[model samples]
Target: MNNISVIMIAHNKKEIIKSQIEQLSSIHNISMDSITIVDNHSSDNLCDFLVSQSRLNYIICDDKIENYSLILNTCISEFVNTQNDILILDPDSFLLPETLKKLSCALNPDNGIYAVCPQNILDISNDIHSFSAALNYVNNNDVSKINLFKIIKPEINTILLSHKLLSEHTLFDSEIISDELCLTDFCINNILNDQFTYMADNVYQYYIGNHNSYYSPTNRNCDLAYIRQKWHMNYINTIPSSNLISMINEPIDKELNVLEIGCDCGATLLAIQALYPNSTLYGIEINPISAEIASHIASVKTANIEESVDLWNDIKFDYILFGDVLEHLRNPSKVIHNCRHILKKKGKIISSIPNLMHFTVLHELINGSFHYTDTGLLDKTHIHFFTYNEIIRMYEENDFNVINTIASNVTPMLSKKDSEFIDALTKLSSHKNDMLFKAFQYITLAEIKDT
Candidate 1:
């Protein structure tokens, strides 16, 4: 049995809320016993209509109340202690009956699973056979039967949280006024805590629609400021992506040791050494000229990462940097493993790679153009390409606990307004998160998992 309680912040849109509640009621064994709807001062009769639903408990927040995180916290706190999982939803995102069933299947307490997300097959709900179709889908759980899903990350649209997180009221940030910004911050915090979140993306389809129509633009800048102040994280821009930067962004105890593979011309080492001037800088580069230049700032060695397992016999670094270097190696996984071996007990590795699913690459593939240029997503130097899912799997396989994942340059650089590809994406339903194809690069930070 699934101990699921549904909670959604419904501001308005009488039609959308009405449909969502009806759909939730029809799910097989799921009932409205612990379900709740927060009517955020709806101008329409939605408040009255929601109250009319005797099955669902409803709350009407006054127009003066603005912080959504506080509202969700209050509602979750009222739940009975027996309810150990809360499914947060957006009225625009409709889930099939099997959505929770699959989530429950993956929510094994032994595995440290704390959250779940469903695979959304783009807005194909109108094409969904029946509620029973979902039932059959989950029962079989065949990989071949599943449609392609965009990697679903944690978003408020449809997510299941452990009751421990909700009842303690730590999942959502009360200080954050922007809902999107708040969820992002929440995800970042959870990741840093070694909390595991699952994406049961292949199990069922979640119809996507206007999940953020209520987002307030006025609060965006403030929320961003809060994130920056709290994390002390500068956005990863033109600099080579490095997890060392995140570790060095704030003050540290003593001078540390840092290493970079493929230290190309040593620009990265110079930049980072400038920030943490006291730390010793080291580099391993294959090109003699680049290695020579890198020696000015870092203790540069002319060597191949794949062949140099003994490159650092006596030294264990506090941090290792791999900025767009792994994808070029014959066995990126093996290179990562060797790097991990040379790290101090708590050392970390930061990496960045061009996203294979970026819209420009997808669009070009759709148009039958499969050519590679000098740089960018299809850089000829790239021997291995990865999507977000593959990147996560790679780190986990190497016995590393991914502390954080940062997606940079998403959507803005690549979207086309009048292209056939844009229409293709529009037809598919996402869980109101950024389209899977929108990201340009994924900059990742991971540390060696403790034995």
Candidate 2:
């Protein structure tokens, strides 16, 4: 009857298991009652060590259970009678002393499931077991440590599931042979069902293994593609019925001729068409596939889809939109300069750039590693990183006057104390020099300069 139950599924990670188990056992507030380990058919004597320690309950898989889903489901099924909060941990995952405490503090009955470390480095070498193994490799000297006591979106590894919620949602997708989408699909499905809110924050330190190919860049890329597909499939259906128009600050006006750069799938364009039916909308995109999809969406919406044109061209436009596009460009300034030229006097340019300097990223950066992933500032396709001031300067230098700037309030991924620690470090770094220049993203509305 401990507050948490830690479950780990390991294959042949003999070298790291002892240390990982030792670290978990040492957590200040957690008890032995909160832990369980499932060793899938391993060649090493992992079972003997677990039995020797007598510290954790271990389940060994025989030839009867061959797949990961069966192993995971079997383990969870056994824990069903425990009636304790369950945490799924990878064998290579190393927990900081305060990790569980912070994660527990962030857990809420309202949020269906929670994860301490939402995203970490995947060790592709672990793919032989059909599970994606990840490591939290932060350059501690360079990156700041994160506090995990904050209620936030669940991260990639390390999930916390309530016993009751587990009963309601059933177990992980045992059918998905690859662990790639099992957890995510389950969580997203539950979230959509309003069964539980998926909360994640950076709470665990992962020591990635290179023994398998689960984390190889290629596999990671494939996982990302799958994630995006899942995300789109699960969430895209809600778009047409969603109240997205309210998210836009100013509605697209019928009198204005608009240019939307990076019009992916026409979600933004279609939304604009709904708002201002008479407005002429133009889109520029680099991905032909996405462009085709967007064109199709536009056609369905009965909105005009113009031929793809480079922004550097001299075509005049009444309004230009960099909508979630600036961060992807190598030289955002060049695009801004070109936009300045095309915009008529008093024209507006509205843009949305993902904030790379968000507190989560700041926390990750302070920890010392910058790894690209499926999402966030490190998105593989992004070429430029800008802070709030840099964004303003980029526009101002190109003869555009900033009319309005809105900074979205985001929840911190770390606990208040850890966030404060990061904030202190950020301030110290800023005072020593200017650090606001590293803001995550900037949303700007600028006016073209008069000749």
The local distance difference test score of each candidate is: 0.68, 0.57
TM-score of candidate 2 against the unseen true structure? 0.46
Best by TM-score: 1
Residue 282 shift from truth in candidate 1, angstroms: 16
**Would you estimate the TM-scores of all the predictions?**
0.51, 0.46
Tens-digit lDDT track for model 2 on 216-301? 46544554566556454312211221222333444445455667776654556655655666666677665554455455434212
Best by lDDT: 1
Runs in model 1 lying further than 4 Å from the true structure: 80-82, 123-156, 167-171, 210-213, 234-451
**Candidate 2 steric clashes:** 33
Error of 2 at 387 (Å): 25
Global CA lDDT computed for model 2: 0.57
Cα distance off (Å), candidate 1, residue 136: 10
**Candidate 1 lDDT over residue span 286-376, tens digit each:** 8765565456557889998889744766998877888778788889888888777789997888888668877678768879997988667
